[model samples]
Target chain A: MARIDLVDLAHAYRPNPTTDADYALRPMNTSWRQGGAYALLGPSGCGKTTLLNIISGLVVPSRGHVLFDGVDVTRLATEKRNIAQVFQFPVIYDTMTVRENLAFPLRNRGMPAAAVAARVGEIAELLDLNVDLDRRARALTPDAKQKISLGRGLVRSDVAAILFDEPLTVIDPALKWELRSKLKALHRALDLTMIYVTHDQTEALTFADTVVVMHDGAIVQMGRPNELFERPEHTFVGHFIGSPGMNVLPAKVEGRTADVGGVPIALGRSYSAIPPGRKIEIGIRPEYVRLSSGEGVPVRVERIDDLGRIRFAKVRLGDARLSVVAPPGVRLEDDRSRVSFDPAQIHVYADSRRIEGDA
Target chain B: MDKPINNAAWFLILPAFAIVLFNAVIPMMTVVNYSVQDSFGNNQFFWNGLGWFQELLDPSSELGGRFFASLGRSALFSAIVLAVQVPLGIAVALSMPRSGIALALCLVFIAMPLLIPWNVVGTMWQLYSRSDIGLLGWTVNAIGIPFNYTNSVLAAWTVLVLMDTWHWTGLIALLCYAGLKSIPDAYYQAARIDGASRWAVFTRIELPKLRSVLLIGVLLRFMDSFMIYTEPFVVTGGGPGSVTTFLSIDLVKIALGQFDLGKAGAMSIVYTLIILAVCWVFYTVMVTPENKGARE
Candidate 1:
């Protein structure tokens, strides 16, 4: 386990990064504790892979430092950085057998042949790839190839950190949950510092202990998985981290209450540093939005989605529509519907940044 | 069994196949027929069996030794061409930018040699290797090195070798460059993350992927070099004492110049077999399941 420190790292694809827009990765300063499993989650062009590449030393930062175990290694190459990385697709040599593919790095490092073989066998068994020890890598299917890639990255327990950049993207949906669980198990067994970057929020939240949410080249917030979902600090985090994302309704804040679409809702607490007489929005996750009769916004039920475990009643209020999660068998029985939510669960945001909250 | 006769498509292929049969297959068959028989004059012939093959097989006598010497020269020429061109071609391919003005400039330069006719290239080098007027020859002579292809076998071989390299290295480089360009940038990115040394990336990735293209390059170069006649013939004219006379040049000398049709035909069959066999072996080794797409 190693404490990773990234001090003011910024990257730009273009030679001259004149403005903030020119940078693919906005300036970031963050750190991770030893033996922590972390994930950088974002949309496709949100600089998640770029940040991963920068950390793996595949991309050089235009400014600032990256220190692993307090050693300044910003200028060092990937080979000198002492980190293992797995690509989005499997990157094994097609000519070599699975065994040879696993043994290549160890042999290149001048590890003992016996030790190399033993480790290769162990990783092969872990990946359920022992039967393919002598089979050519080219002959394997896409899923098998990805397993080899995952195994290769995890094979070396001696590396300071292991980085993965969307390694499970090529995997099938049915196998994704199983593989993600396996990765979590591997991290627990080895205690290696692992950093995973993915665009899928579910993948990040479920697999990582801490999820770092990035948006438009900047990290909006970083916290534990539950913290990200329960209290998203930024609007982007709220929309990004959950399925049937948190509903953000445009409202005007008046002291401790918000008047949303001619309906009054109490915030139950005052927010400091944010002046009242401005356009403010209230955000609440669907799970926290309690739907009942005649207590909240006057809206018409557009449709109802039955997901078996819970029902999502999509209601249109003024110009915006909000999804409210109801208990199973709850259906929209009326055209004109009234659904309400707890005021404590509501998060206030002025612009895209969250207003100061106790959460 | 009922078979459909598609006469409409047949019309398109009939003319092309007829032309090939007349120009290529018939001539080859005539050679094959001549190889097994004794051709006297005006199509007068007698059966000769394997006597011609027997004569070339034993290299003790003068004709036998000449046959072996020409074969050896052909092999050496091919070896030299492979040695100079494959690495040089790969280096040039690697250096070429994938797109834009730099690639355009590279394309223009690579196309220059390809545009020159084989005989013209030989003639160009022949004049360019003169001790009096040519820059290379004049420089060498002025620097106190006696450089004359008319006399020195080494000088003639050097001139012809350089001419061949100039004629075909561009083709090899272009083929390899196409293959290299087809490789995804992801492979390089993966290599970077894997912390591969430059040589390892090149050896494990680039070179292995280049296998198919390089096979085609080698086969084309080998066939061209083996059957080479025009360029070397025009430059050195088989040299003083036949030092640069390749098998093709020797076959032409026997069949057309000296009118030994039977021997030339036999040697032609042998040459074709050698090329076919070698190329088949190359295709098999490179495109096999274990070795195929090894780089990917």
Candidate 2:
């Protein structure tokens, strides 16, 4: 397997892209360490799939090079690049038997028949497709067909990487977890470099060792799932990584104290270098915002959503709405309430970029 | 427990029943009646139950031999047309532009042949194959080949087959094109990732996906060409000693030209049964699991 590198990769669907808006993938450089499971997580049309396609050689980047273990393969066709990819939908060969479907990739490369059959048998057993090996692919259910798609990719032993483009979108909800755990198991067993693209945060967080959070066409942060959750380098990552997301309140910062809305709050870290004209905001995850009795920002509780284990209280301070997690049986009786933020959990952002501060 | 029945639903089906009665049932019954009886002048009829069918099926009889010979010709014509049209149609469909203004233009031009009426097509080919004045005949003659559709059996058969091909290959190609368009882009991408060659992609992915539509095309072509009468009738008129006369033309010649209604009716029933049997066999074979599983 090869360590993949994207050097200054940028792609545009249209010819002659002169601005960032015209590019599907804005200029950026990133690399995937050998044998690491990474997830490119983003909202729809954020160019995660474009980046995956570039890596798979399905689409050439408009202005960058893709190197596999330091070899420039920018102009190589997908067949020559030795990559495997599973698409968003199940794409099994409808006419072939399940066994033959698994053997297709190896046979296409002119592998010996015995080797192909052995590989097919191995992948079929791994995917629980042994009994249905002789069945027509069209007759199986969607999940089974998707398993065949995975099997086809896994059948090839020498592929540099296997890229997945939202492969579980069509799976049943209950089976999604089973297949995801199976994928994680397969990663551990085979130790193949894998890159999964998805918009669902849970899928990204649970499957990837490192999650690359993207917005608009550029990566906002790339770190371990917990790092992305704890210390988001961009406001987009802070707002996108968690359940109910992070609450961002506009702030006026000077030295170590800040005024949020109308109340002056003590800063946990210094933001003295932040200029006066720049827009400054304080970000805190919903998990860290707590209800207080005496000292905190005054808020009007609007609604409380009970989520079985934890509840989210929607509160408003001035015109901004913020979510605070309340324990199982907390009551919100009065219209006015006080909520406090943990100093270590607070993040400062100026112009959507996380400003440097002491943790 | 007795179930409550809604008799009013019967009223809703009355229109369809009446249409079928006038369109299909009446003519079928009349044909059955004609097949079982002999008719003379002045509305006089005699009961001849099974006599015409017996004569038509008996190979030793003159009418039976004629019927068998014409049926063989019809089968051969259909086989040749299908063999030529299906592959050619698939190739043309594969070469067609996928999108943009060129796709629309290609579709319109390909559909032009199918839009021409059957009789008009027949008459056009009749004049177009004239050895003295027609472009094709004159060109062949200029190239040192004596081609006269009126006098040579080979020339007449070629013109007949060529005319039919030109008239109907477009329909098959259009059906195949629709099938090709329905396949998603993901299949091609997956094939590319799997390192499949161009031929592998076509045989494994494109051809298999086109199976159902190709079945439809084959069935339609077989049945239509088996009963073909119009174009050949107008252009060749079973010329050069009946070499190009197909089943429908022979049936017409027997019933209308020779006034043998009972025999013709029997032949017509037999022809329809043959077509139905072949179509059923084709449909079953095309959709069976064995055929699907046989691919690798």
TM-score of each: 0.89, 0.97
Tens digit per residue, CA lDDT, model 2, B149-194: 8889889989988988999899889999999999999999999998
lDDT tens string, model 1, B1-296? 99998779868888899999999999999998888887887879899998777776779966678788999999999989988988889999988988999899988899799899889998899889899898888889999999998999889888988999999999899999999998877678766655667888788789878888998998899888888999998989998678999998998988899888888888888878887897898778767755444433
TM-score attained by model 2:
0.97
Instruction: Give the Å shift of residue A223 in candidate 1.
Output: 1.4
DockQ winner: 2
- What is the DockQ for all candidates, taken in turn? 0.31, 0.57
What are the per-residue Cα lDDT tens digits for candidate 1 across A126-243?
7889998888887787888888877777777677788888988888898888888988988998899999999888889888998999998999999999998888899889998788
Among these predictions, the greatest lDDT belongs to 2
- For TM-score, the strongest prediction is 2
The whole-model lDDT of each prediction reads 0.84, 0.90
RMSD of each: 3.6, 1.9
Q: Tell me the docking grade of candidate 2.
A: medium
CA displacement after TM-score superposition, residue A96 of candidate 1 (Å): 3.4
Q: DockQ score of candidate 1? A: 0.31
